[model samples]
Target chain A: MTALMIINMRNILSVIMLGGIYSLISAILFVVLDAVDVAFTEAAVGAGISTVLFLSAFAITGKHHDLKRRNHFPALLAVLVMGAGLMYSTLDMPAWGDAEAPVHQHVAPRYLEDSYAEVGVPNIVTSVLASYRGFDTLGEVTVVFTALIAVLLLLGAIREDEDQS
Target chain B: MKKNPILRETSHVLIPVILLFALYVQFHGDYGPGGGFQAGVIFASGIILYVLLHGIKKTEKIISLQTTKLLAALGLLIYCAVGVAGMLLGGLFLEYNVLAADPVAGQHWGILFIELGVGITVASVILAVFYAFAKFEK
Candidate 1:
């Protein structure tokens, strides 16, 4: 519904605002799913900072810009095929929260039961993220660090070079 | 945006609370639903709010670009240093079992410091990103 509304909207600013609302609604959906941590992140990031960033970028780029029309049939077909394939594939998976699901059968049980005793943290998610999977988290943090470097190079550093030239 | 008194006053009131909430989320992750990543983004959003209401020029006076860059690197280094510490302490890389008198305590210490590193890097990197985007305005 909101996606359709956004697609039909012609104003870039309104579109961005509606996208932020979509993010907020998804964050609320995460909350409804009992993923408080994920909801917190989605609300803070997707709803809050990201919206601000997008608005700022839009402002910097231009105001009162027109949407450019382009070829859409190929893209539309590709999206429909991908969507159908994904939906068809999901029909073979186990139901939500099934005990025999691959995700629940693996390390999750161990983390759920023993993480508190082993890691001395009541929150199993944090224990798993920081201790049992420390290497993975280290890699993730490195990725975040690397993203800053990339953005700085493209926007911050390159801009300076052009300014001087 | 800066010219609006309501925006300025509200942000002034809200920024401190947001930062405090971030710290709470960071330290209380062991017992709660939040951790470094969430807390870090929340913290950066506080600074972004300041920049929004007060303008980037004034915001930079308090948190210089160099400071954010340095903090980002420092955070990455802190995480690496913890891993290296594990090695030097007769454990494998990032093995928390050797960091304290007991394995559990070592785990606690290791996770705390590791999350700290993650929080620092995430917050600074986010601020740096906002700065980059804001710079394009003028």
Candidate 2:
């Protein structure tokens, strides 16, 4: 919420830095939730790479914030509605760390029981992510590859055009 | 950035440590908390730091744009090759049990290779993007 306030103030650099901080805080939250792997990713990608990417991209544009004041009521309304809807939905969800949760009941036990025997990796997250869901990880890598190609194509063409100009 | 010798020296000292940490995260992920994605981003950030401190031209001399592009593709290829190798070994795609005499060892090898592939591709692609953005002129 404080990050949102910083962003709303129209300071681009501050916004980027605050965004990094927000990611870092969320990473800490993930650690509290016992998801160290998720925390690691959140810290690396969100706080580190994203902040650098934003700053570098900002270099292409002027640094000063535009002083255009516009109505933000519609956006505020949309956010409020979405937040209310999400909160309302969460009321029906299982309590945090509940053993009787549907997710805990289904597939969790099997993974816990068989992962060591089947995959031989002590880290169940590694086994599940790399071995059990190898195809999905491959798809994700392909997606990253596609993103790189897209960036290259777009930026490379712009560079060529600039050179031609 | 070049005018600031302190920042330059500090980053020079820090980048190697960051990169070493990235490698540790990449290889030690099986036992610890990190994996390819986290390690890759950390590694790229180290390169990005180098670029920030010493202009992209110098960084390019260290790791050229063509090399980054090639590495990005090669990483993806390495991952796909692993899956195909599994198929050729008379198992379904990505089925690691057939990769060796011992299924457990095969799983380890397959995960290690795939994670390495993922780490390589992610690091190179991110570095490539950083290069593109850094190189762009208004």
Model 2 stretches with alpha carbons more than 4 Å out: A157-165
Please provide TM-scores computed only on chain A for all of the candidate models, following their numbering: 0.88, 0.89
Clashes by residue pair, model 2: none
Error of 1 at B47 (Å): 1.0
RMSD of each: 2.3, 2.3
Question: Candidate 2 residues A1-165, lDDT tens each?
Answer: 856677566777777788889999999999999999999899889998999899888878867684767898998899999999999999999998998899988887988899999999888898899999999999999999999989988888335545755
Global lDDT of each model? 0.89, 0.89
Candidate 1 Cα deviation (angstroms), residue A91: 1.7
Reported per model, the fraction of native interface contacts reproduced equals: 0.85, 0.84
Share of native C-alpha contacts between chains A and B (below 8 angstroms) recovered by candidate 1: 0.85
DockQ of 2: 0.75
Per-residue lDDT tens digits for candidate 2, residues B38-126, read 88989999998898888888888899878888898898898999899999999999999988999999999999999999999999999
